[model samples]
Target: MRIQKRTAVAVAVALIGSLTLIGAGTVTATAEETSVALPSASFRDIVVDGVHDRVFVSDPTGGSIVVTDYAGTVVQQITAEEGAAGLALSADSSTLYVALSTAGAIAEIDTATLTETHRYPTGSDTSPQNLAMAGGKLWFGYTVGSSGGIGSLDVASADPAATLVPSGRYWYYAPALASSPADPDVLVAGEEGVSPATLAVYDTATGGLQKRAERLFTSSPSISFLNDFAVTADGQNIVVAANNPYDHQIVRLSDLSSNGSYSSWQFPNAVAVATDGTVATGAVGDFVKTYRPGSTWPSLHEYGVNDLQRDGLAWAPDENRLFAITGFSYGSAPTLHVLPDAGKLDTTLDVQAPATSRKGKDLTVTGRLSAAEPFPAGTTVEVTRTDAEHPAGTPVGTFPVSTATGEFTFTERPRGTGDITYTATYKGDGLHTAATSQTTVTITK
Candidate 1:
């Protein structure tokens, strides 16, 4: 009952105040955020349909799916289902599958028409909460009274039905599921509502489910209480967000080994991976951060918000923008924030120079610019020199990087004595984030 109220004025003030706060590190990019008030107070999941240019948000409490355009304007609201929660879109973005928790079914909505054409009943009182599509099947996490399990609905079947997976009975609540386009046959699930959560990776190739690996976070106290997690685009790793952890962790999907993490504020509760392998992680601390694939360093972009709800993050198929659902406070209408240009690749810049160089002598400054995506041809890095004389820094030269190796080198004569700092900055282009690295050298007689 309380979830039906709206506080547009208070929500608007919170959005404006959040804009003035820096969400992450020094290199965080500024994102223009546009928020649209929603009809629901409680939300479960978000999915973006790039083909139809629609964003769907499911509200379990309201028992409906709120559909919006790329601009966050509500185009339609489908209330044919009860307790609508998680959402998954077909590869072609033609069909949207909704998990009807109270109705115990998966509703299929024709994206173009914005109508529910069919509802495949999972069973009586299954209470499906989260959904993912992989191996040509719609996988769902469901609860039956006190127990929870995972099941799949073969959407392509003539008479589609939900078949329970026996390997999914290890949770008190329905787990969160994730899959990757790169490895469509691989599915990953993390137990929800359970501290010291257990994560299981499944091999669903050929439409068969088999457990490949699993890990219980009991060994690491920081990893308890799973909030949200995602399988990387490459399907080689799983990025996890936990309540006790101050960072989102990247772990191998094979053995669940430690890989890397995207460090951020505490209470990381939501995460999503873009088609381009860019990872967007959100925390209730009111920040959403994006990291390039496989990089544990600082994020490429971080945007501030009121508060990112659990399972609140989704990226458009084109990776052009990100759609986030916020506003979990009581008596507030949920706000959909559209973040433009939020999927840029991250780059690393390293500048190396001789430890000592003779005054007025030639010194070579060399380094490399590395990124998951290749740099454009003829990419150049701007180099600067800073010392006691040029405290503000002086332009040394613009050096070109070997596109093949991302390495760049330039020669500069040391005119200023004492410790001279050579700073190499890659101004970055549309595809990559700007990176800067510095190395110091002493100038001697």
Candidate 2:
């Protein structure tokens, strides 16, 4: 694996690598350069192994999977032949799985040894692609015969439970499968390889159809395949990439919620989602790098990922340091870049005062932590008053949490107050404070 140095200039109307603000014209932020590593395969597949803070890049060209630490060191490399393509890892992060499109078999790699421990044939004439490993089993998209959808292989025990469960026998070609981060079910995105490509959701655990949708936005007759997208780590949400013909926009799953049409949500990516379900996606409308749940304003300042030729995209548990992978022609191999890019974490703290207050008297305010993205777990969140519309040190309360979650709600309602200030601070790991987000309520005294 090698890394290179390159610069990405933002679109005239788009910010290169920033998170978007709600109603502002895109803002641009500058990133400092840091070392990083690029996959040996020019066309590579990437998956995050959160259990170890390591991300594995599958290089079909080299028949290897390159393992890089958070600091961008190539710690290990596992090689395989037959040109491996799609990749998957178990929910517990114990195994590394691959789809050998040419080999017509799913190859299993033990992350411990980086060696091929097992391989199962899909069919004599099968083309298996994009994999998702979860719930004591492995799932894949198999474009075999007149069948489409996904196939399953369970390697939970020594008996070798490998079974192919085709979702629907549509004429659809290759598709991508990912287990829902928020649920036990799985979501499968596929296209018929022509106009009106289809994206379907299936229950691989039970072979039940949850949803199958068509009318996906695509302009080309021979449409572009969905490269990479993600489901949230919690498993309740799923986002997919569907390039609408000449129109490019990451589709949103919320859009599909209305009719359960599978027509709702949108987000684009080449490869996405870490084991924890932290996703980094490519942008469609204005900027280059974007993450969904809808882009906020601040991301514009950081520069969304642009210039794929220069950098590869990565997400961090901190939600602040984004590792950009790049390649340069070195004397022996391409240069490895684990470029450290910083992202703005606009975390705000909000708490309801006397949340369930009775009528009339003013309830005291306490601070709570709300985040755009997950930081680290076990981080502290403090509560405080903004200014002297009141007094200082008004008996503030605090809590500890992993900055890596949606939000944390703490109830330490203050009593007998006209006005009060509460602050949440994350001490240790350096001192950090949330923007004072507050709310007020009234109760009968």
Candidate 3:
């Protein structure tokens, strides 16, 4: 078997090069980047508690969990049992459940107090990997000997019993696991190893398997483990980050079929889907990029942070913020990044033309473009003309805006009488809404 591969940096450059053909109207949104260093270099998972305005990071090697504020400020560090790897937050965001691999137990932490409040033992030898909160219970994947499977603990029930889903010999202790936020009955799991990776969907309500798909990489030995995967808020799409060329695959949940695949600038270690249908990817070297589903081209929003060791990405809908965990790779220090939601731009278009002009005479059209933030100096604006003869309008021409004053001008000779409408439009960047302005001029014989 032959395997195809390309470096993420080269792909990003090619994507950027292609943008020039789409005209200068497209602009990349700028992000304010801030980082908070962690005491330990080794990090596993990260979760956000919107209700408490805090973020939690698991430091397995340090045997501690670091807590930070929404602004990426260190708040506190709470000690945990050894091998604290995966983390899950309760529905109300009041309690955080942690998987202590070495201790073979799940520990619960109080958000306000930042302390371990309770510990539930899974078993003496089971090593839990990833955790999810669904069906009013805590679902986790554990590896025992050569086999592993999914298990759940009904935290809501008075007894809170731990039970494993009945499945034949399967590798349930995969690196990627997620539960649908909209539907508690849906759960996604996958196996990451030298053998072909298998992705499966389970119906938690019936403990029945819904669907499974196999992903075989020709050169599997060279590929590392699958790191990040997310289920869309609507529970309709599953995004998985796979190695050996470092690409993201989107799968439709209804039929478990491939929807699309995307290339990244770096190995995407973490991925997340926003409530509003935005997909964010955090890769090695702190390269973060976002895209709209089903689009062939990448969006203009990208963020870069120095010495960012990619780990996990989490979205906080209530606060409109993205929290990214960086560290545990490339000999870089562990840090947390806080990126605020993209900002909106206010745009205005002004058109100037003679009130009346003679037929066959030059009709000079001028316009100025302004926005909340300064746009690229020579960005292009499209112009169109409509007259009584051709009310539908026809392309006049495309002129580049003046870098000095954000103004554009075009001269056209009239050939017909009656009113002529000249319109100037700025087809907005993905981050900002587009704007249009027009002015009418009367031509008499």
Give the winner by lDDT.
1
Q: Model 1 over residues 57-124: C-alpha lDDT tens digits?
A: 99888888899998999998888579998899998899999999999889999999988999888877
Clashing pairs in 1: none
lDDT of 2 at 75: 84
Error of 2 at 41 (Å): 3.6
Give the candidates in order of lDDT, highest first.
1, 3, 2
Stretches off by above 4 angstroms in model 1 are: 1-31, 220-222, 345-375, 378-445
lDDT of 2 by residue, 229-323 (tens): 55655555444444433222234343333211122123233334433443444433222333333342223223333333211355555443445
Query: If both were scored by lDDT, which would come out higher, candidate 2 or candidate 3?
Result: 3
lDDT of candidate model 3 versus the reference: 0.69
Which candidate number maximizes TM-score?
1
Model 1 root mean square deviation, Cα atoms: 12.1
Give the Cα error of residue 133 in candidate 1, in Å: 0.9
